[model samples]
Target: MAVGELSEKRPTRYEIEDVEAADRRSRWRFRILFAVVWLGLIIGLAVGLALTGRIDPAFILEVGPFILDGTPTTLLICFSSILLACVLATLGALGRLSGNPVLNAIASFYVSLLRGTPLVVQILFWYLALPQFGVVLDALPAGIGALAFNYGAYMTEIFRAGVEAVPRGQQEAARALGMRESEVMRRIVFPQALRIVTPAIGNEFIAMIKDSALVYLLGVREVLWRADVMGTRFFRSTETLLIAAVVYWILTIVLSFFQERLERRMARGDR
Candidate 1:
């Protein structure tokens, strides 16, 4: 091959850096444009609602703080529930993958039952129906339990897949080193499995944040519950509900941004 032709094909280090810089610049430009457009649309909607007398600026100012006060509770529920779900999912995955028929059957039944029932019903069951059987739970605990149980069942499959995705050779090598099965899983398999399913866990967490609003039905005083109370009191349901919706939307966007950053960091290991 000619030297000039080889040089043209391979590209110099400086040339490669220049191309990467240009690409990054282009991406940033598009991102800024998209943000501007999104803001414009939101502003346009607010103006239209105001002109139509569907929303009141003064009412929003008064009620916004009250609704926002519930943000901490909402976040508490989400974080607490996700932590519990992670534990349950890990155990459930093990049960599902166990060689013992009893363990497998229990895990299968748990997953099947939870996945079959609606989340709303499960929430109610914990908060309401359980009381009749003398197993009463407080509102916060009920909410957390329901959310954790429901999400754990779904996440079981994700965890199982992550565990199974670990190379068989690695487990064999661990066994050859005389590690017990439990030790091998704990030291070698589970860590890699957790990393593999992290993105899925992030997504489930985002969904759980939104689903946490359902706890309002149990009167947990979350964002939606607070908004509902204030809206009913003032007879400005539209304004209160819209503000709550915006809060949830903002939370979702913020969480999604962090999730993307986490995913990028995790992807670096692959490279």
Candidate 2:
């Protein structure tokens, strides 16, 4: 082949850079276009609802802050429940993994019983039925307890899987160093298991935020309950509920963004 012809066939460094830049520009354009389309759809829906008298802008403006006032309580419930769930889930995972028959059975039954039942029933049981057994709890505590217990059962498998993901060789190495089983688990196993499960824990935390709305049914006055009260009192149920829905949607989006970032950071080692 002629040297001139070979040079023409192969792109220069500047040409390759130009092509890469164009690809990035194309991707950014598509992202912006999609964002615009989504915004247009949401705006059109809001306008349509307003035209049909299905939503009230004035009512939303008046009541939005009132409903948002309950956000702290909602966050409190979610955070507290998740913390408690972490403790229970850790213990439950250990129990599930233990060779002892009694601990294994207790953990197995707990997971089965909680996971098999509706969360609403559990909430009601804690708040209402427990009173019959002289174990009465106020609405807030009852709601938190129910959420923690229910999520703990579900999270147990996540924790157990995380623990199992830790290589057996690592544990053996620790044992060779004269470490006891408990010390090995505490010093070598749990930390790595925690890193593996952090993403799943983040997902559960986001889910728990939404599930915290269920606590409103117990009259703990979270966002949904506050919305319901204002909606009923003002006869603008649609508007009030829409506001609450927006709040939850925003919360989910924000949390998901952080979760993505955390996952990316955690995955840097793999890259």
- Pick the lDDT winner: 1
The CA lDDT of each predicted structure is 0.94, 0.93
Deviation in Å, model 2, residue 236 alpha carbon: 1.6
Runs in model 2 deviating more than 4 A are 1-14, 269-271
In terms of lDDT, model 2 sits at 0.93
Estimate, for each residue in 1-271, the C-alpha lDDT of model 2 and write its tens digit.
5754655798566555577799999999999999999999999988888899777677789999999999999899999999999999999999999999999999999999999999999999999999999998999999999999999999999999999999999999999999999999999999999989999999999999899999888999899999999999998889889889989989989999999999999889552
lDDT of 1 by residue, 1-271 (tens): 4755766888776665577799999999999999999999989988888899777899999999999999999999999999999898888999999999999999999999999999999999999999999999999999999999999999998999999999999899999999999999999999999899999999999999899999999999999999999999999999999999999999999999999999999999863
* Model 2 root-mean-square deviation: 3.4
Off by over 4 Å in 1: 1-25
